[model samples]
Target: MGWLRAAVLGANDGIVSTASLVLGVAAAHGSAQSVLIAGIAGLVAGSMSMAAGEYVSVHSQADSERAELERERHELQTDVEAEHKELAAIYASRGLDPVLARQVADQLMAHDALDAHARDELGITEAFRARPLQAAAASALSFAVGSALPLLMVALTPASMLLPLVFATSLVFLAVLGALAAWAGGAPMGVGTLRITFWGALAMAITAGVGMLFGVSG
Candidate 1:
């Protein structure tokens, strides 16, 4: 679900940005070829950008986790008793009685000290650990897939029909994306749909206005 959520967000960005760029170009009375080319370029650039951004962001988190774990491992080596008490304090803070917490911490540390401390003290677990490559791939793939939808509209619709068709269909795409994301995350589908659609609409409107201004000026 975490990866799914990231993919969904990346897709949403791809759809909204490509759609808005194409619509803006069309509004400016750009030729069909011009808008089509613009959409393609946007797809390529947007996917790459998403990939790079996700990689950098997630890599930073992974770095922090590594540094913290390294420090914890050193502490465990130098001050075994202190680390045990620290782990017990954590368990106590979570509502366990001090004696029980100490006993549990002792057993856990004896079994696997680093793993226990990593999970309990630092809140770093395998399931939740950041994987930069996975995030980059998911973001890039999802963005390209989402951008393809709007590009298809550009290909099929004639110049005269491009603006309305693109806008209408992109809104539908966003509504579906939002609803699916909401369902996956156990959120309100209607609220997600409304929120995503509203932002998409606003972006398109702003882009169209800018294009009109430029078109009129030039």
Candidate 2:
């Protein structure tokens, strides 16, 4: 589930944004065609944006991790004693006795100097390691899937019922998604559901209001 966070976030954004866009246009008394077009446009734009953003962010994290590992590797090559002492100090600070810390560090270094330093010193681990392509794909695919839900409502629902249906359905989807994501992350499901629903409601409300205001003035 390394990609769960990005996937959940991307899907949440996709649902909220496309639903909000559809609601706004519908509130403006736009035709079915206009609403569908807006939703589709929002979906495409949001998916691409999420992909690019995740790629850049994860790539930066990967770069930083690589840089730290390389620095540690160089230190191991040029100053093995210093690296060993530094690692021992880390273990000592973590509550091991001085002698025990030194012994533990020596054992770990003997087994794998680079890995020991990378995990303990640089705080890099296999589980949390950044993968740019994985993150990008997860974000993009999740977004498209989420966006499709609201757009489906637009396609099926009549113009008069479009706003209400999309609003209600989107909120339900967001709440369910939030709860599921929270469960995955071992957090409180209720809190996550409420948080996502509240934001989705607010986004739709604001956008719908704007659309109405313009509609009235025009």
Report every candidate's CA lDDT: 0.93, 0.93
lDDT of 2: 0.93
Q: Lowest-scoring 10 consecutive residues by lDDT in candidate 2?
A: 1-10
Q: Compared with the true structure, what per-residue lDDT tens digits does model 1 show for residues 65-151? A: 999999999999999999999999999999999999999999999999999999998989998898898888999999999999999
lDDT of 2 by residue, 1-218 (tens): 54787899899999999999988888888889988998999999999999999999999999999999999999999999999999999999999999999999999999999999999999899988999999999999999999999999899998878888899999999999999999988999999999999999999999999999988887
Using Cα atoms with residue i matched to residue i, what is each candidate's TM-score against the true structure?
0.96, 0.96
lDDT of 2 at 12: 96
lDDT of 2 at 156: 91
Query: How many residue pairs clash in each candidate at the backbone level?
Result: 0, 0
